[model samples]
Target: MNTSLLPTRHWLLAAFLLLATPALWSCNSQTTLQKQLSEHQDQLKQIDDDTIQSYLRRNNLLTKATKTNSGLYVVNLVDGAGAAVKTGNQVRMKYVGRFLSNGAHPASTGYPASYGDPRYPQGAIFDNSADNRTVCGCAVFTAGTGLTAGFGEGLLLSRVGDRKLLLVPSRLAYGPNGTTGIPTDAALMFDIEILEIL
Candidate 1:
């Protein structure tokens, strides 16, 4: 028996095993973490969907609400007869953007004017064109640009004077990285009245 080589071989085997163990364990740990994150996101999405559905049901808009391919819900509260608003058109709108607050919202406030009071039943008003109109004239932006993806899509579906309640899922708005006012995973509601295709 080559005793001298035997000990060296055993030592090498031990070193390799020690090195490989952590790599194997790390992959397993990463997988577990990924699974947990995916599950958490799924739960959040379910909660958001439920909240929107409940709001629609409460407002008797379930039948009228149409969900778009990207998961935007548009309820045409007041229909207008005119040419369909197109992308790149300058549109003037009166909009109140809020999150269908989950009761304990931090309460978004401060606008060109006083931000509307936020109560659980009323939801938090992040922005209101009604408040900003005097300061800037009801929001006049080129449609399909400089707006959230959901908002732009909703505009494309409207004509002049169409009053729409747009329920925008987080995925369509800000996704995981929310903007300054919108919270992560927060579903948004835009009560927008198309004033004109300017």
Candidate 2:
């Protein structure tokens, strides 16, 4: 074998060069892939919201009381006669919180059903349950204060005997970290029934 006669140097250089090219491209390629994934996720979320709004519009359902803000919408339902309420005024109610996308029960508590699993973390539920002296576990919340901005806003819009739906974005509900039943950065849906305001 006349090694000196062969273009071994050129062959080795070409192989090494080819190998180096992919390594460099891999880094850039991975970044591009991540960006595409993010874009797709965002598009899906937008489509989901658009579909929800379209359905609501087509139904022509009355919310009674409604609040829409930044990728979220809240609705309060009252009997034909509208009545208002104030927070810090003890209130009792039945409620069910669910995921808008899947309609899975996320949180529930009260009565015989009250002794069941409450899916998500609710400040009012946790706070009331801590006191055995509390009757019916009525909650005292100050509207526009002493609660998350969404909760406060929703409560303020609610009235006695009113069943309300609070739609909360991550920023107003759980933010970036998220809670037990809710996924990270997930939007929230709450169906609340106001039994009494003392």
Candidate 3:
């Protein structure tokens, strides 16, 4: 038995143990952080849902609004006489994109619940097809791809010339990677009118 080699072996064992311990701790810490983020998102989702219900009730739309299986609320203002729209059909339309008048409180929107969002007034338009027509011809999009998931779902429920008001939750809106002026997990609203289905 070489005494010098024995010391080297002991030092190597100690070094291995020290390195392994921190790696294990790092994995545990990462998992904990991920769990916390998920919980926070869940809380925000619940808050948004509650606010949507309150808005519907206060506006007397609780009974009038049709809640789709996936949670999009639609108010069919004008029923179209034209043929029903299909999944891949190209459609010409007009739309006004707006936030929910932001019923969410400071917990999500950073504003008091009593005072509505000044930037996004009750009916103020954040985006509209008339303006976008110069850009990508916003008045047109394929039934399944051009719009957000909730928006597409709403369109599928309509026929050419149908006018609808869609209440889209954040999960179905821009989602985590928000669009310009919109934040993460924000529920949105859209006033849409189908001009023609091509």
Q: Model 2, range 1-198, lDDT digits (tens) per residue?
A: 788956988899999999999999999999999998676446434543543454346556434435465455666465524457665655555555554332111232221112212443322232222243556544445555666566666766677777766765445665445566554444455667776666
Pitting candidate 2 against candidate 3, the one with the higher TM-score is 3
Of the candidates shown, which would achieve the greatest TM-score relative to the real structure? 3
Candidate 1: where are CA atoms >4 Å away?
A: 1-34, 102-122, 133-137
Q: Please state the error at residue 174 of candidate 3 in Å.
A: 1.8
Error of 1 at 12 (Å): 14
TM-score of 2: 0.48
Query: lDDT of each structure?
Result: 0.76, 0.53, 0.76
Model 3 agreement with the true structure over 68-100: per-residue lDDT tens digits: 877888988898899888999998888888877
**C-alpha lDDT of candidate 1 relative to the true structure:** 0.76
Q: For model 1, how does the per-residue alpha-carbon lDDT over 7-78 read when each residue is reduced to its tens digit?
A: 899999999999999999999999999998787566555555666788889889999999998788999899
Q: After superposition, how far is residue 166 of candidate 1 from its true place, in Å?
A: 0.4
In model 2, state the lDDT of residue 149.
Answer: 60
RMSD of each: 7.1, 10.8, 3.6
